[model samples]
Target: MATVESVKTKDKKREKYIVTTMKRLFKNKLAIVGLVIVILQIILALFAPFMTAHDPAAQNLANRELPVFSDGHWLGTDNYGRDVWSRIVFGARISLVVGITAVSLGLIGGTILGLLAGYYRKLDAIIMRFVDLLFSFPGILLAMLIIAILGTSLVNVAIAISIWSIPTCARIVRGSVLSIKEKEYIMAMRSMGASDLRIMIRHILPNASAPIIVFATMRMATAILSTAALSYLGLGAQPPTPEWGAMISQGQDFMWSAPHLTIVPGIAIMLTVFAFNVLGDGLRDALDPNMDLQE
Candidate 1:
């Protein structure tokens, strides 16, 4: 009964914390706009087939390169007369999938490595040197190289983005761990005969999670951009995949006479990236201890 009651109390506290965080997040104007846009895209992605008015892949040679609002089409038709709006809606799935998946993988891997590097001084130099090596290449360049070696595909794009993302996450987590591991509570845990892993996982990580989450949101935006760039370069999600970058690539030739094909997808990518960035900034401000006391 006591244990169950204690668990209930903890659950209440967790719920309260979540509620407070959400309230704080929603209070920011830019965050609210970002949240709405993100939610819209997520909904579009989750129900792409049902949401699209016409088949994103179905082509009509007769209707190819139609102007925006031409006939029944809303945005316009692409080079193949595939519905631009449908492709844009469907492309949300690819962008979100690549961004969330790649960043998640990088976050998990980086957090572990960062914790190890930050906790153990003996391991710091080695791990940081490796991170330095990765940083020598920019994110897109690194992803491009990885894709070149791995081949073009959705999974490969995610892997490449993950590889490029790891170093940033690792650096953020390492910095957090370095600061957290030196806290008094950590010393108290060390004095309590607690194992290093236990202390790291239970105490250090929870304290560091705020920054990690903020970084993850920001990294997700970058990952999405990288995925689009790779697709544009013909190294991601082959033909008819409806990936935003590929969509943009396909529309480039019609840019002069019928620019809607490229413009629609380009706008979608820009809006999505902007939304994530705004949300990330808001989260950073909300989660930062220093900002908590400020207006």
Candidate 2:
């Protein structure tokens, strides 16, 4: 009965902590704006098919470069005469998915490497040396190199970005794990004969999660921006895909004739990146243990 009561108490405390964190997060004005922007983008991505009337891929030479607010084309037509609004809406889905998927993959790989390296002193040198090898190269250059070898496709782009993300995440997780593994509770768990895996997963990981969460949030912005950059360089999402980067690439030729084509997607990428970045900043502040929380 006492064990059960203690478990329930812990659960309640966990819930309270979450609520308090959220309350602090909401108190930041910039965080609120970032949250709203991120949510808006998600809504647009989720309902992309219904958000616009015209098909993003369907082209009409007759409607080529139709100016913004023209008849049926709200944001105007691209040089291919595809609806700009439809493309942008659909592009949101691509950006968000690619960002999330790549980050998730990177996080998983990094977490495992970090946990193993931090928990086992023998493995630390080998793993960190490998991480150092990856870190030696500039991130974008490394990604571009990977894409060059993997071929120019969306899947390859995601893979490349995820690979690029691994080193940074591994370093962060390793630092957190090192700090947490030395704590008194962790030492107590070891003395109690708990399995290494159980102790690491149940205790160390949870305590280290605050920094991980912040890194993931900030990394999403980098992922989105990288996706666009690769696509613009003709190393990612192919033409006619309506990807923001590819759209910008396609629109560059018609810059003088129809500047809206490039401007619109440029703004979209900028806003999405900004949203994730400020939200990440807000999360860092909210999660800081040193910060005083208001009642």
Candidate 3:
């Protein structure tokens, strides 16, 4: 009964913390806008078929390069006569899936490495040296190199981005662990003979999660942007896929005559990245104990 009551108390505290964090997040105007954009994007991605009538992959030569607000095609028709709006709507899924997947994999791998490096003194130098080697290259360059070796495709792009993300995430988690491991409670746990894995997983990781959450949010923006850039460069989502970057690449030839081809998808990428960034900033501030929240 006591254990069950303690668990209920902990659950209530967690719920209260979440509520307070959300309230703080909502207080920022930019964060609210970002949240709205992100929510809309997720909705579009999930309900894409319901959101648009046209097939993103289906082509019609007759409707090719139609201007924005065209009769049936809401946003316009691309050079291939695919409805730009439909394609953009569908593209949201590709972008978000790749971004979220890459970040998740990277975070998992990084968190493990960080825990090992920070907790076990003998492994610190070896793990950190590996992380430093990855950090030596610029992120984009590293991703491109990975793609070049792995071959061009959306999955490959995600893999590349995940690899690029790992070092940074590892560094962040390592820092947090380093700071957390020396705390009084952590020492108490050690003195109580709690297993290292239990101490790291159950205690240290939760305490280190704020920074990781902020990093993951911001990294989503980077991952999306990177996916688009890779696709634009012909190393991701091939033609007829309706990927924003591939769309941009396909449309660049009609820049003067049918600028909407490039402009529309470009705006999509921009807004999505912007949304994630501002939301991440809001989260970072909200999570910071020293930061002031609006009343």
lDDT of 1: 0.88
Per-residue alpha-carbon lDDT of candidate 3 for residues 24-136, written as tens digits (9 for 90 to 100): 89888999899999999999999999999999999999998999989999799987789999999999999999999999999998999998998888999999999999999
Candidate 2 lDDT trough over 10 residues, lowest sum: 286-295
Error of 2 at 83 (Å): 0.2
TM-score of each: 0.93, 0.97, 0.95
In candidate 2, what are the lDDT values of residues 34-120, reduced to their tens digit? 999999999999999889999999999999999999999989999888999999999999999999989999999999999999999
- lDDT of each model, Cα atoms only? 0.88, 0.93, 0.93
Q: After superposition, how far is residue 219 of candidate 1 from its true place, in Å?
A: 1.1
Candidate No. with top TM-score: 2
Question: Model 2 residue 157 lDDT?
Answer: 91
* Total backbone collisions for each predicted model: 0, 0, 0
- Residue pairs of candidate 1 with colliding backbone atoms: none
**Residue ranges of candidate 3 with Cα displaced over 4 Å:** 1-13, 292-295
